[model samples]
Target: DAQAAICMVRGHAAEWNISADKIGFLGFSAGGGVAIASTMSATQMERPNFLCTNFGPSLMPVTVPADAPPLLIMTSADHPNVAAGLVALFMEWKKAGANAEMHIYGDGTGPYELMPETGETTTESWSRQMLQWLKSKRFI
Candidate 1:
């Protein structure tokens, strides 16, 4: 769970010179499940400072906390699996009065292809989008 990870980091923070507040979570697919779990966990320490979900499931209901971490969500409009859920989650988060942002990519060509790290593909640029969000929050 995120609690263990956060605690470990916090425990070594002084020697590692990394602040607990700067730690965040970014997840894709199944990993996003974990991210969501971490965000909605009852233990505050288990939560990340910020979170990014890339085309993840949204059915896991959570009571958005006042201190809910900033969130960035992305999904291809044409994605066969999780696009609708991701968008639903974006709206849900907004309605929950949480700090949330979303991006729905893809054109007539269908969802952007997930290219290799060295390759430049439209869907692949989603990583850059995440980075930009992190930058806006001064996480990078």
Candidate 2:
């Protein structure tokens, strides 16, 4: 379904007034695992230009492709399983020489929210940080 979506969007890029090369995938929590899976065995036409996984780690073993898209992983340090999984995914990307960046926020232990809550910490700034990363990578 993810590959189908990518193909659909890319195929209609000009009609949609979007650049095919700028297409990316972003998933949160379990959806992140889906995003990762989408890339693992994708053909060139089905691959996203980049991937962002927010507090969502692959549920299964990962095999990073040599031509894997740049990756951005965001999670909270206190969320042991998520943090560890994201770190492992980042390491796999690095081992494959794929561009990857990660942010393990120190203050929280669960999925970060987009809206700021009372006494919010840097975890809420993930969206901004992600935008900066995208810009830096020229993906936007």
**Candidate 1 vs. true structure, TM-score:** 0.81
TM-score computed on alpha carbons, candidate 2: 0.89
- 43 Cα displacement, candidate 2 (Å): 0.8
Please name the candidate that would achieve the greatest TM-score relative to the true structure: 2
lDDT of 2 at 9: 96
Kindly list the per-residue Cα lDDT of model 2 for residues 1-140, writing each as its tens digit. Answer: 99999999999999999999999999988999999999888888899999999887744579998889999998887778887888889999999999999988765446544334545445557877999999999987
Worst 10-residue lDDT window, candidate 2: 112-121
Off by over 4 Å in 1: 107-119
Error of 1 at 119 (Å): 8.8
Model 2 RMSD to the real structure?
2.7
Clashing pairs for model 2 are none
Error of 1 at 115 (Å): 9.3
- Each candidate's root-mean-square deviation in Å? 3.5, 2.7
Model 1: residue 71 alpha-carbon error in angstroms: 0.4
